[model samples]
Target: MLQTRVIIILLIVLNIFHETTAYIFDVNYSYKYSTKKTVYSSVFLQQNKKDFRFLAGAPKTDNILICNTTVCKSFAFSSQNEAGFEMLGAAIAAGNTVGDPTYICAPHYIVLPSFRINGRCFALHENFKPIYSLDNRLQQVKAYNGSYEFYYAQGQVGFSAKYVEDNEFLLGAPGVLSWKGTVIKHTDLNIKNILQPEKVAEKNSYLGYAIEFGEYYFGGRKRRCAIGGAPRGDNLLGQVSLI
Candidate 1:
């Protein structure tokens, strides 16, 4: 099951005609949540209030590490803004001084240690290209090229990896939501569940993985959603869906 808490902070009004296609210029944060037995979680969020932008994500695993009980493992695929400046991989590899070193460039150019303990876990991958300009933005702040974070407790834990495609971003740099459009109009269309297959599931044979889950929260709270696409393969990409 999934639990969501949405708080609207302010008000907003559109500045153009209905014809202006909505555009997300910048993003503050996007996150996912999940649990163990359920197997998958379908999550979505949107900016019902003014100023906020459409930002949402699906929990990559069945365990919600925030509980601190069951272990969690999963991977995510994403990209940073092609026009933004972001650090590649060195930062993540810096936090821990544990494990022995080993490297590989096949699937992706990455380096991992042979063994690691808590406070010593680490994995490195490219973040995205530079997100901000060196001359104008680098001096003010520094962000990762992209981020791939893994969470676990002990005993048994899963895995997680996310790829942030350069142009697969929606929010604007820092303050701007989008150079395109910020205002939103709600549609009765439901969100796409990330944990379930787009097609219906059948007995004995299922798509992806199996999970038991449910959601907690009612219309009393607010939600958000975004539209995007993933690369299918062979130079072809998939259709755009709400994230």
Candidate 2:
């Protein structure tokens, strides 16, 4: 009886080995974790070669539908075209999808140069920040949707950031340059459950014509710095798109 059991175990092991090695290896990937899975290889026209997608191995033959996940409820906003405190307010008040263009140039901080329009080294007017969804919002305020996602803010994985600042070692001033003016924010988001999801009322625009103005001043002004006439918002307006 023990000899029979050993023979059966050996046959099982060999069957498993045969099934595993039947796969045709591709030079692109050799995944031990993912095998025999279907991956969409048709590239999106808007995507670059860097965005190619492929299964680690063979596509599974199936007669029935099977999926590991369901598409999460979502809203894909084209982003608002306004800037400054208005942008933040609109996002909070009109909960849907928000997306801001390149915020690196958004008027975040400002430094005064050798000149000023009126008084103070630099003058700031629009720093008005209304309470919203971050840790700073009102006590009763919540995200109004699904609980916070652990993987959503996982440190810039899907997208990449490019630094446009000048080389730090080769600078004329003592410290880095500071700038300020207006700031804009927009994003794309999805409600976890659409059936009973939070309903954001139908509105023309959340935060429109919003503007923020601020300034920065340091001790003395050997070097002058100011960031005015920054690029205005575009592609946001009332153009809302669904993903």
Candidate 3:
């Protein structure tokens, strides 16, 4: 039952979008044996309001420990000296003389650490590439060599100038949301509010809910529906039904 919940939590978080808000301290572990393949492990650093929460899980084993610098625990004892020295060197380079190491140590770990805010958690694939990070905008031109896509569930959509070349994007046909008409002069503008209607849609696209997982209610009851857009024959779009 616990493992099942963990899978659902990961799915919900991956479906939503989030921007970074806090520093993440990550610890990695690897294991190998003659008969069995190596296993992967990691620790997460998370914050809630003013307090912190630490959790440890592993698929192969469940006896995991998440502790701060003062605690001395070990999973792969052989790697301790080398990993410790390397971490200390990194801290020294960052100008910290007295640094204690935080660790996510386990023999066979189960779950990855995570934190949630606004129904989203930080999760990414091993090969995830950051498309935009450089401060200069001019260098971002033609940075992507292939096509990318965006899918919407609910909530406002914001577009950035980093991915756009001439400050324009297509909406709704090949893409679900395209620029209404003109080149977007302000790259920082919220495109959802200013987008033009698609031929099939009655109004400019607007999603009225936050991306989340839980029981959702409509019209204060289950099985109720709400209509979006004005009631003109040309403007009326469709219904949002609660299941």
Best by lDDT: 3
* Candidate 3 C-alpha lDDT tens digits along 111-220: 11311000101101111111111112231122222643122211112111111222222111111222111111122234442232233243333322111112346678
Worst 10 residues of 3 by lDDT: 87-96
Error of 1 at 7 (Å): 56
Model 3 stretches astray by more than 4 angstroms:
1-201, 216-243
Expressed as tens digits, the lDDT of each residue in 1-243 for candidate 1 is 122222221111233433254655333553334434443322212122233221112222111111112333333333222322111221111111112121100111112231211111122223322221112222122222253212111101001112122212121111111110111111124211242221221211211111111233447764344432222311332233333
Q: lDDT value for candidate 2?
A: 0.20
Per-residue lDDT tens digits for candidate 2, residues 1-243, read 999999999999999999989978875764232224433211101122343211111111211111112311111122222221111101111111122111111111111241111100000011222111111113112233355321111111101111112210000000101111111122223212111112212211221122222233567544323221222212223322111
Query: Which of the two candidates, 2 or 3, achieves a greater TM-score against the reference?
Result: 3
What lDDT score is found at residue 28 in candidate 3?
A: 55
Against the hidden reference, what TM-scores do the models get? 0.16, 0.13, 0.17
Model 1 misses residue 74 by how many Å?
33
Counted clashes in each candidate structure: 49, 11, 9
Alpha-carbon local distance difference test for all models: 0.21, 0.20, 0.24
Ranked candidates (TM-score, high to low): 3, 1, 2
Show model 2 residue runs off by greater than 4 Å.
1-14, 17-243
